[model samples]
Target: MRKIDAADARLLEAVQQDAHLTAEQLGAACGLSPTAALKRLKRLRADGIIEREAALVSPRALGYAIMAVVMVTLDREDRGVIDRFKQDIRNTPQITSGYYITGDADFILTIVARDMDEYDDFTREFFYDRHPTKTFKTCVVMSAVKTNGALPVHDLAQSAI
Candidate 1:
């Protein structure tokens, strides 16, 4: 990965917060001309500094009232088992995010469902029958305090420099 300068970092901050920001607005936010901002934007996209911009959809609004954090421990940690598990996560649309974390659990997943029964069904389909998931723990979210995944680009850049 390439290092980002101050202006580039500022532009990233603004764009991540709101992808709809025009060249003029981004330039104003980052103290650059519209032309300069546009140029930087193109470079950022080309360099993969800025990945695809996507809308943050709410699962609650779409009748997915159940949100769960599932910590899974597989019986075996072989390459085949792990690959199959990862593929399973990708195939499952209800599993929004999956992380191979460094902890007691082999994998962590963010799962959404319409209700309790749906979530139970998900566990049976995903864990019980599919993978060699030895044990899995579920933590139902009572409240989502913070969900917007905006990075602190400007601050990180300042510290890095």
Candidate 2:
């Protein structure tokens, strides 16, 4: 892992908030010269600390009106089933993210679709007919109270310096 200093931590925090910032802007925010800031940013990207930068588009604006968090309990927890299910999830674009979980559910998925009809189609294709899912429960999002996708840089406080 690349050693990140206080300046790097400050730089990371600023960039996470806004990835579109120019080198000059980043330097000013992080108390570095433009040259130093650019160097660290390149290092961060090369070391894979800063992953892909992408635009966070609004699902509603894109006509994806439904967001569902689904807790899925599989019929079997065997290695083959788990592997296959993970692959299936990877191929399914509607499933934005999935976590292998503990407790009542084997996996939890964050899904988005155009509407209830599209959501139903997804369930029919992935859950009801073909998949090994035993029971799945969904909670449709009424309103997103918080959607900060940025990871916390404060956790690196001790190590960063």
Q: Model 1, 141: alpha-carbon shift in Å?
A: 0.6
TM match of model 2 to true structure:
0.91
Question: What tens-digit string does per-residue lDDT give for candidate 1 at 71-150?
Answer: 99999999999999999899889999999888899999999999999999989988998888899999999988888788
Backbone collision tally, model 2? 0
TM-score for each of the candidates: 0.94, 0.91
Give the alpha carbon lDDT tens digit for every residue of 53-160 in model 2: 878778899898999999999999999999989998899889888999899899999999999999999998899787888999999999888775788775575453
In model 1, the worst 10-residue window by lDDT is 152-161
Off by over 4 Å in 2: 1-3, 159-161
Among all windows of 10 consecutive residues in model 2, the one with the lowest summed lDDT is 152-161
Clashing pairs in 1: none
Listed per model in order, the count of residue pairs whose N, CA or C atoms clash below 3 Å is: 0, 0
